[model samples]
Target: MSSLILGIESSCDETGVALVRLPDGGAVPQLLSHALHSQIDMHRAYGGVVPELASRDHIRRVLPLTEHVLKESGTTLQDVDVVAFTRGPGLAGALLVGAGVACALGAALDRPVLGVHHLEGHLLSPFLSEDPPEFPFIALLVSGGHTQLMRVDGVGDYAILGETIDDAAGEAFDKSAKLMGLPYPGGPELSRLAEGGDPEAFKLPRPLLHSGDLDFSFAGLKTAVLTQAKKLGDDLEARKADLAASTQAAIVDVLVRKTLTALKDTGMRRVVVAGGVGANKLLRAQLNAACAKRQIRVHYPELHLCTDNGAMIAMAAAMRLQAGREQAEKTYAFDVKPRWPLDSLK
Candidate 1:
């Protein structure tokens, strides 16, 4: 009999539900069905995600998305062997929506429930693809709220090598885009505008390039963009694309160099890039090139997978279930940890 897992993800503004069929003997898991509802448009006006709004929206969308996943997968609730949901490192209200729904469903079906770390979902996302990386690799997680270098020894073993002291890479991109007059969620938009502009047009500082540690800092670079924008005065709008391009180049340069350094320091040839900034074209291209040049391999989830989604949450849950990490209790009570730590798991 095949084990079907239903995964719920509402860590942020996206509500994702997915089903995965895990077979015996370590065969590759199959994606049965997945559904996602993005609250991007709803929060776009605010220039960034609003926590209260995000929580409210998750409550509205989680149930429908779960139903959609079941219908799309052609499976009934009884067929699901386990229910999994993102449990922490996210907005309290948002995490509760997923946890509440998943626990309720697990109780109704009399199945085991598991709470997965949001970043672990990201770390294991590459497994959803054709050729996944093996264990004991380096991971550079650069998202809107975090920037860290980690050593992944196994499914539940993670060691942090270094992290950011201030603003994350994604936050820097968004802030720089704001300075350049781009709309909210400005990271991607800023990259698009940069396509036609010259990366060498402006000289932006690459913060912490030679800090002699794995830690990163983009706060200074963001300020540099502000200085440049202010210097341009009334013509800032006209030179927006150029400014965007320069800012992106500086960011990518720092990320690539730092990641390569991590790889070299650890002697780990395999590196996986995760989180929102993982979708940046320049970063991908430059990192790919750098890895190739050093005969090192780098892996990334597909563009859609790079951002927050349900499939990864489900997949990671399946892995944990197979490993017999922990089983769910017969409790409908669930609470969210808004500031949970990944290292706290081990």
Candidate 2:
């Protein structure tokens, strides 16, 4: 058997391809090569991803990206033992592009295929880092569309601690940024602007900060940001940085506190953060500082892997196969799940 896993990810605005070599015997898999194409610039003018355009771009990017990954890995399609792709909780059209291509390739190569859950890929992404996390850690999954706390015991063993009831942490960031007239992908832009201003410059609500449970709600926070911007009125532009700082502070505060509450409740001493928002420096710094005070180890995906990427998908698949949590299928007929829950993989 080739023991090479090929992963494709087109769940949203990014197209990614990667190759991972599952180690002989029972060692962990190693990432070989991966390539990604971001559609952020393309969607900037529109303020968000357009589903049809994203699907078309995935078609144009996946194959060439796959070729690049194979070439960089010193391998070819013939060496692939399994093909994996993000199968859901995303735009249906975009999901189809990756699922269709992955299935077609699997059929052509006579290799089995596995449909990896998108969030599961994110949750397991830290394993690709140099300081990979051990099993049985608490996970905080914060991204553009989702915010969740999970207890991961093993490859397919996950228990969601709590999830967002309304707006997620990322959504809170983006919407707050939009109110400040930041760029389309507003979260990072807002975070950047926030650096120059005092986080206490404006008072923002930390929604659900004391709700007494892990459930998150950021919708009210976004409303507070909008109100603050309107109050600034003609001076909004000059004071935008302050607003950004305050917004980020509110979101980060809620996330950090809730995460700590989860840790306290579970009595676990280690936490792993994954997904796009995991790349935010403020969140990372706060989490690190907080965890340090409690002697809890905090792990994160490599900065590059913090976003949707091929390496995590491939690594997740390899781990699943290694643990016998799932079996690769030779069947080529496949479908995408635009709303699959991460814990459903169990």
- Model 2, global lDDT: 0.93
Provide TM-scores for the models: 0.97, 0.99
lDDT of each: 0.88, 0.93
Query: What is the Cα-based TM-score of model 1?
Result: 0.97
Question: For residues 1-346, what per-residue lDDT tens digits would candidate 1 score against the true structure?
Answer: 6799899999998999999998988776778888889999999988888989998998888888888989988888999988889998898888988999999998888888888899988888888877788888999898998998999888888898888889999999999988888998889899999998889989999988999988999999999999999999998888888999999999889888888889999999899999989989899999999899989888888788888888998889888766666565666677777787776765
Q: Which residue pairs overlap in candidate 2's backbone?
A: 89-338
Clashes of 2: 1
lDDT string for model 2 (223-299, tens) is: 88888888999999899888898899999999999999999999999999999999999999999999999999999
How far residue 120's Cα lies from its native spot in candidate 1, in Å, is 0.6
Residue-pair clashes per prediction, in order, are: 0, 1
